[model samples]
Target: MSFRTALVLLTLLCALIWWQATRPVGAPATPSRSGITTSAASSRCPMPPRTERGAMPLQTDVPAGMSLQAIGETNLRPLAGFSIEARVLGREDYRIGHEADISPIDLALGWGRMTEDAVISQLDIRQSSRWYRYSWKDTPPIPVEEIVRSSANMHMIPADDAVAAALRRIERGQRVRVDGWLVEANTNNGWRWRSSLTREDSGGGACELVYVCSITRE
Candidate 1:
């Protein structure tokens, strides 16, 4: 080829070689809308895994202010549609301090139900000095001990002989059913939840007894 033609040919070859060398190895990727790389894009729009919540089981701790029907059916199962019975299990007194005289006011207790509210109420009002018995321990157990004190506000209305005796039964481990209302109260401690039921189906009287009731499922 003539010098001029040869030069032109050489120039074309150089241009082709340079273009091939500068070409991208893989896909000439485009920027995402956010201008981040593909790896970053994958992370930004990552997939979320699946999750689930299991079936709710029956509970015994009656939520504070829950109705009697609600307590029996949900928290206290095996009691569906059955009227809850509250018996004044018994009266119990506990000594607060190491010495009898130094101890705080005696704690009367009656426990027939299984919620924080009921237990607190039972201990506050229905429970009396007589119902409390000392379990065998290293020595005579302290009365009104911290462990036995329940924080419930209960009314001390006069109860009939049968009703009073029923309270004793509860202290002795007898289980009695009660019919009443649900009240909610919050205190210095955490949530105090329970169910309260006065004895109904009898004549209209002041049978304002309380109980602490809870539920457990097998």
Candidate 2:
């Protein structure tokens, strides 16, 4: 094309970009790197004045009629009804392995004293390879057993696309109530993964495998 024609097209493109850049919250949300469009521009997430000090996670018996649920070629069996209101200490996203095929995210959640900044600031918490780990500089802030009892790494299988989007937006330090089922996943190929039945244990096989229905940010 002619130089004048190209110049006019470039000007229009620049103007369009500028308009979208400064657009109001009502404007359409752009897609994330993963191609999921978020409503964060229209949604307000206010920071709480203080960390919510909530009780431990609540677990109950699996309700009647609960059975095998299919996800990504895997069948999930409800082991127990599980719910937790805790501070999000850390988050990890996965895109590989059988676990990622179903549960793509894991949250390092902390409750009780673990939720307090006074306690958290004294520790170094991290998550990877579907596990959560923590350490301290000199003396430990809390007993290792109490820390084990109060915090965990939870694999999250979002129940729907909306829940998946919400899970992606979760940030560190947000106190959120995650309501769902503790599940054991099995495949016809004989692959199996189960949720831990107790929070009083630590190390391998202690993480909870959750089928998340809803997450309420507090």
Candidate 3:
């Protein structure tokens, strides 16, 4: 190849790499899952009441092959045993400080008829460490208050490596069932982290700190 041609090609390659690295990530495509109905009428279904305490014991049938265990208090206080079957709205991974050693998966989960609504697709949802954020161009399908209460940003502390790996593999828009306990962690220096049992509130201290014992995709 001619020397001038080679120089031009190298410059183009550099530009391409730069563009690829600097480009923003576009919004994810709308998801379509079997048995999930995403119609405007479905949004009219009543929203679940706001919870102020821990989740009740599993009354619904547990998925086959799933195991349950009593999580005794170790260093953290096990406030309540909890479980939920919801859709994975968003996920964020962290790698810093004590949290780096355990509890890396932070999931924004949605349940009820909201799981099938196009509102989720219309909104740009994202999670950064323990925080969740969303934005939309047009009017939201449901009330913003209902959406806040229906979904939550949970900090999942996996009970084992296998469960952690499973949580890591969860994708956006997939249905996930999580079984665990709500806990509050305290450090020797007096720093502490606790889970919020209520879904009606927002801002600081509203996130659930869960020690997940089992996780599965539906």
The 0-to-1 C-alpha lDDT of every candidate, in the order given, reads 0.29, 0.80, 0.67
lDDT of 3 by residue, 49-101 (tens): 22232342232222344332323332566666666778889988888867545
- Which has the greatest TM-score? 2
Which tens-of-lDDT digit does each residue in 1-218 have in candidate 1?
79999999999999999999997443222334445322111111111121112211111334343332222112211111112322223434345422112111222323323223433333323434322232333442223443233212232211122222322333323222332223332234353322233321122222222322211010
User: Each model's TM-score?
Assistant: 0.19, 0.75, 0.65
Preferred candidate (TM-score higher): 1 or 3: 3
Ten residues in sequence with the least summed lDDT for candidate 2: 41-50
Among all candidates shown, the one with the greatest lDDT = 2
Those runs of model 2 whose alpha carbons end farther than 4 Å from true positions after fitting are: 1-53
Span of ten consecutive residues with least summed lDDT in model 3: 38-47
Pairs in clash, predicted candidate 2: none
How well does candidate 1 score on lDDT at residue 178?
A: 32
